[model samples]
Target: MNYTAEAPAVWDPAFADADDCLLSSDQCVIHGEHCFVKGLIEIPVIGSDEVFSWGVWVSLSRENFSRAADLWNRPGREDERPYFGWLTTDLPVYSPTTLNLKTNVHTRPVGERPYVELEPTDHPLAVEQRTGITPARVREIAAAVLHPGSGGHR
Candidate 1:
């Protein structure tokens, strides 16, 4: 599915409370002026494909990043682990829609950084639902949507 809309805005404090924010990944990094994290969500489409996994990226504040890192490093505190933050980001391969996703962060290999598992949400990309899509197809769509002419790139 293809869509054209105004570029999605940055994290809006009016719509969310920063104090209650939780990001999905613990491997967030500071790039230039912004902190970024990536995760994946499975979209339930109504066809032979049933579901497809799509990548999602989110922006985080310094405070939230520190909090997530502390929680991530704390030992023997599995039960009280934090849920991924409800912060914001533009969908990597779709229209600049504001997506609120549920995520589970976990440790990867012995030496690698932790990663996140983004769950399904009622976002437009999930609802639009396509079938028989290849990784190449997804990449192409993303390239088109994130191209210079496609609104303002996030």
Candidate 2:
């Protein structure tokens, strides 16, 4: 998924105008929209390693969200399956900016407050180390990446 481009000429405004940055704390996808389950974006497989820097996005559908939440909370569920989480081979490389990893997790047990249990393979810690990105930041970036005509290239 590595897509290289010549260093920008005049700071291509298209990059700025691109519509990424879409996720919110409450809403995954806007109502009545066609959500997607895109691929995970990883960082340099070589070089310095870091942890807890990856994020996950899945087109923001109620169905996928519920499914992921269930798996995180309930590992014993029969429908549980592995999800994808990766690093960006390209981007608007900046901290505190959106552009994140994407994956799914299961819901936590009832009466134990609210939480999700992500599988170890898809763990944010491992993904971040591989990608050198933060989990929360990844989500923010993912929202932007998924935005229409944003040159997301993740």
User: Which candidate leads in lDDT?
Assistant: 1
Q: In model 1, what lDDT does residue 113 have?
A: 38
Q: Using TM-score as the measure, which candidate wins?
A: 1
Q: Give each model a TM-score.
A: 0.40, 0.29
Clashes of each: 4, 38
lDDT of 1 by residue, 32-95 (tens): 3445454434444443454454444544456655555566555643444434554245555545
Q: Least lDDT summed over 10 consecutive residues: which range in candidate 1?
A: 2-11
Q: Which stretches of candidate 1 lie over 4 Å from their true place?
A: 1-67, 71-82, 110-113, 122-133, 150-154
Query: Which lDDT tens digits does candidate 2 get at residues 64-127?
Result: 5556544544545444454332222134443333333343432234322121122234444344
Least accurate stretch of 10 residues (summed lDDT) in model 2? 1-10
User: After aligning candidate 2 to the native by TM-score, how far in Å is the CA of 26 from where it should be?
Assistant: 8.0
Angstrom error of the Cα, residue 143, model 2: value is: 21
